[model samples]
Target chain A: MKEIRWHGRGGQGGFTAARLLGMAASLSPGYYVQAFPSFGPERRGAPVLGFTRIDTKPIHDHSKVYSCDYVVVLDESLLAVVDVFEGLKADGIMLINSARGGEAFTASGRQVYTIDATGIALAVLGQPVTSTPMFGAFVGATGLVDLPAALTAVDMTLPADSRAKNREVVEWAYNELRRKINA
Target chain B: MSNEAWEGRRAFISANDAVSYAVRLCRPEVIAAYPITPQTSVVEKLSEFIAGGGMDCQFINVESEHSAMAAVMGAAMMGCRTFTASSSQGLMYMCEMLHYVSGSRFPVVMMNANRTLAAPWNIYGDHRDSLAMRDAGWLQVYVENAQEALDTVLQAYRVAEDAAVRTPAMVCLDGFVLTHTYEIVNIPGQREVDAFLPPYAPGENVLDLANPRSLCISVAPEWQTEFRCQQQAAMEAAKGAIARADGDFAAAFGRRWGGMVEEYRCEDADYVLLGMGSVMGTTRLVVDKLRAEGLKAGLMKIRFFRPFPREEIAALGRRVKGIGVIDRDVSFGNAGALYTEAKAALYSAGGASPHTVNFIAGLSGRDITKEHIETMYRKVMNAAAGGAEREIQFAGLRWEEW
Candidate 1:
């Protein structure tokens, strides 16, 4: 089973991103999936959590994800507020929406995929929220889910007028992952 | 009924844990409850299940009981079986939605760990919590033990979600007495529980976005009275539903007890002690002691307090010589609330109202011993024999002699 925890603000579309991922996972053969928000009376800017569980076997345990194989952070501010890296598996990957300024990292060498999803979202989608594009980056980092499939999931969640920008951010994240993997 | 076995089961869990297991068996599509003492553990357990992938339900840890009830109400309105748990003050906090859940006539099962209301601040077992919300149009049943707590919660879903009478019900067990007390509860196997309670269908929920309808909306006084009358009818209807559900539960689980009131040695009795919550267990022990001595005294466990179970209570009043209502909760100035309700139920019943004496004991967890029960019974017998005037009295209270 693969468990992914998404960290973002309440209105940053973390819940939508999780569900879309589950929908995409559900469409895939040999996969059973679940996606849901951690219930809290969080306001728009409050940090929130959404969870996704995908497994070949029928999942039986439904406790919070104590250990996650992948952690997607839509808002960089979450890292300061929450112990975002607390339970990341040794072989797990971290996807962040803050890779724009070419910042180098000396953090542990598991796998880190960063995309300036916020910049892409703001310029293209006209909002700085990075959940949808972060979903693309999440798919890009692990190749666990198909990039095209993840983008389609993102498109379904976004309104039509803003679909083009979301798709662009997703495409850019996918390319960034391809380049990082090749390097 | 006692020896029926479900193996790989016996979990020495708290009343809250038993409640959580029952809720899981109920298969609520949406489970929402806020964290409050005694009640919090159940929600925490379910949250663990939903989080760990054990239960496939939307477990919501809402900000308050109000939102918790709101979330469940919304889900239940959309045809999903819903659940929540709360205690004394928490139940009071969500009083508004309590009416909404039942008024909407949605099948939402709530487990209330009866506790004393705060001001002086007490968190122990008492009926003041559930008793306060008694008239909010919900079917209320009290359980004395952990196993009953578990079974009744599952049955509550069956009774509440049933198409015939789709009103919300509170399966109340005493706080700490059951909520915190650890006991061997036979958690029913999934298949057997499934057979007893089929998956809840959203047939009654009128919410179809395509064809929208508002529920629990304001109505003219005339229309409102009609709705309340319907609510009253449904509560009384629950007396039958409780009987049927208990029978079906017995047939399916081999655990059966007669309807709303569980009678213990009430037959041919001259004196009966009426009680609810865990104190009933104590009362039963007292009744047995009295019965062993050849005293024609028995105990009546008042499980359903809301629809008042007027007929059953009236019949008990007619049969018994003297009736003592041992209330673990009070209606404040009026003394024993349950006792008061029972007296009202008996007023219309013919005979000289069974010397109904109210014993307000076990408030905020004061232990009611066998001696206390015997004393209370003697008082009732004296009252019945001499036509004593004391209607409300305290059974066990500390006093200093001058």
Candidate 2:
């Protein structure tokens, strides 16, 4: 099973991105996926968690993810408030949506990758929400789902008026991270 | 996951949304339900469907949960297929009407998102909401996932509207855990659901002017005993109706939840852990893990609580050496309600071979982690091997005192 935890504030569309990941992964025949939020005291700016579990077999565990394969932070500001690395596996990768360099957040024993998801979101979606852009970066960082599947998920999840822009955001982050990782 | 797509109607949706799709397919003439957290999404989705003209049903915007049940009961009284839903405090608000619907022999089906009751003021998943209504004269069915939640809604209509069992049924989904959680669900075609459920044949149980019948009348002590006996008989008859509905549903939909209780890997098992709803899903994984480690572990999932599966429990007791009952709701002063009922069912099991331990956890939506389930299995293993173990143990407790 591949578990990814999304860290973002309330109203950031964190859960939407989590669900899109599940939808993208489950597009194939062999994959089974589940996405759920840590729902509590939900407000505009309170810290929240959205989790996605993708696996070849059906997921039977209903509990919160304690060990994650990847942790995607939609808001870099959440780094100071929440311990995003609490349940991160030793070899797990941490994908952050920040302008800071990856080395700034990278601990000695951790793999930390940074992407200007908000910058991409601002440029592409004309919005400050990093969920779509970070979603792309997640796929780029993990390669959990194919590029076409990720774009298809954006199209399936977004409204008709915004589908094109959101798809662009996903492709931008995905290709950017792919380019960086290859370099 | 099966390789076959069932014509590829698969979609990713929450269990609450799945219930909305199932309710739409059932073609209920009247849909009435008040909004409540977790459950509010189901109500919203249903309203969206009705607004979009996807369903030809009267959507009742009731003032309160009490009126929600009353509206459905009135519609059902007129021989109209009806549906309603509630959860937590909302379900408690409909307590009076719960008995009224069941006592009047109205086959009103409801979807309840199982949530923790408020005193500490929580809005999370727990079985306490449904277990508290154990004697409400309604048939309670708990589901494991979005697919079961959808399939059971159709089967609930079938079982409830059965001529033998004219009992109201409540299909429960664990709040937030199952309700808000999104998963890829195999949505069956509406034509298939319609074919399987057919239509709700009223069969003379209606308040019609031409029929000239008195309904919802009070029965005096002279005949109240017989009325109660008939209700009890209907409850007993529901056991078979539930099984038959599951069997027929399996034939039609290619999925079966083992009727009342699904025993997973029970054959040749020494220790079996029993639970209900989503917790059982987690427990099933733990059971498999234990089996892989050479421990004879099994999972007994209680699907139906109202028509308690005692015969199956007794049969399981006769086979296993130790049985662990994991209940998400406790009966307050006593042990977990599920554990208490399982023990009551195991009263006449000849010799005291299978030792019982109750693990009360996941109250108020606390995470019943894999480790917690494994701990329950370990305790069951210990008790089965004649090792000392507490009769009732709480899993994942912050402070382990008594």
Q: How big is the RMSD of model 1?
A: 17.2
Candidate of highest lDDT? 2
Candidate 1 docks at the CAPRI level of incorrect
| Per-candidate iRMSD | 16.7, 0.8
- lDDT at position B21, candidate 2: 79
Question: All candidates' TM-scores?
Answer: 0.67, 0.97
Residue A63, candidate 2: Cα error in Å is: 1.5
Q: Which digits, one per residue and each the tens of the lDDT, describe model 2 over residues B51-148?
A: 87677899999999999999999999999899988999999999999999999999999999999998888999899999999999999999999989
Evaluate residue B355 in candidate 1 and report its C-alpha lDDT on the 0 to 100 scale.
79
- The CAPRI category of model 2 is high
- Residue B165 in model 2: lDDT: 92
> What is the C-alpha local distance difference test score of each model?
0.77, 0.89
Error of 1 at B100 (Å): 1.6
TM-score of chain A of 2: 0.97
